[model samples]
Target: MRPGDIKILLVDDEASILQFLELGLRNEGYQVMTASDGLTAVNLVREFHHHIAILDVMMPGMDGFEVCSMIKKMAHTSVIMLTARDEIDDRVKGLKLGADDYVVKPFSFQELLARIEARLRNQFPHLLNEVTIGPFRINDQRKEILFNDSMLSLSNTEYDLLRYLVINHGIVLSKSKILDEVWGYDFGGQENVVEVYVSTLRDKLEDDDHVLIRTIRGAGYRIDLP
Candidate 1:
């Protein structure tokens, strides 16, 4: 996915800091949402599906620790605590509450961006790189897949399904989740279409032994990538 496709949440009680970050990140092509308080930030997390959050610790009502906890309980969003205090106690508190990183106040904008990139690299590495697994190579930019040194002619649906599985390799994705993601939530197609498409992809990849994609019987499908 491109930079604009990654949604980032910015929360700071200071209006100027929030505006500065929103402007700078937007200039860098990020989709950003800002909140001045913790409750609004939590509500946005529930709706925006943000990939990462930069939260200030000194908020009025909820504070950053509470917001960080709420966000962790609900979403898989990576959190970086932004605060003026550099005390080890505060850092430890944030880390114990599931905050992924810590950024001190008075930090440069470039440093913040670097921290964001570092977090993305650790948390969602698949989003920023082409995927290669054994005999398969996936170029997301070109939306092309090469298998065994041969390009596979894939329909759009097939490409989407394959790429989704490849990026999320080894994760057991349920039929309902796959259906909503690949076929879209509004798709009128039958759920069995996922199974059919899986078979088609396996055949195209020449996986007659079904070793590439494994079915968990009662659970779902997981792609094993080398």
Candidate 2:
């Protein structure tokens, strides 16, 4: 999706920082929402579906790490932690807590925008243009998947996994392969994440008697298209 089509959430307790970043991002054609604190950020998360979130590490009531964990559980929103601390431990902590990227204070707006674009491109690769598999259709430009002409309310992660499976249709993809492709190469998460997402997709796409995605026993999962 284009920058104009993507929604971003900016959360910082510092009013000046929030306004500066929000104004810069908005000028670049991104739909930007700003929150002054972690609590307000959480409330905004519930209200709107954000594709990316720029969260400040130091916030009252709830910290960035806590907020990141909460948002990750709710949706597939990619997170970038903003902190003045340049300590290695702090950066590692944010990554461990599921933040896609971290930026230190005093960074340029151009740098931040570059990072945002990089993360988005990584999530939605260039190869994901459009693919049709039987009754299912994937349109990456629109960031949507259609099943029998109806749109599927899929999370970002769900859409990526489903699109990957359809691209490699009829091939049994191992969990490790899927993890690298869908969750990224350096995703230090459990393999069961793939299983959980696959199960979710099956529930949404499969019928009681028909299975679009098949488990290949010791192999992996495959979507057999006619």
TM-score of each: 0.58, 0.58
**Model 1 regions more than 4 Å off:** 130-226
Highest lDDT, which number? 1
- lDDT score for candidate 1 against the true structure: 0.88
Screening candidate 1 with a backbone cut-off below 3 angstroms (N, C-alpha, C), the clashing residue pairs are: none
Query: Residue by residue across 1-226, what tens digits does model 1's lDDT show?
Result: 3688788999999999999999999999999999999999999987899999999999999999999999999998899999998999999999999999999989999999878876775577557755555677777667788887799999989998987787567789999999998888899988899999999998998889888888989888988877
RMSD of each: 8.5, 11.7
Report residue 132 deviation for candidate 2 (angstroms): 25
Alpha-carbon local distance difference test for all models: 0.88, 0.85
Per-residue error for 37 in candidate 1, Å, reads 0.3
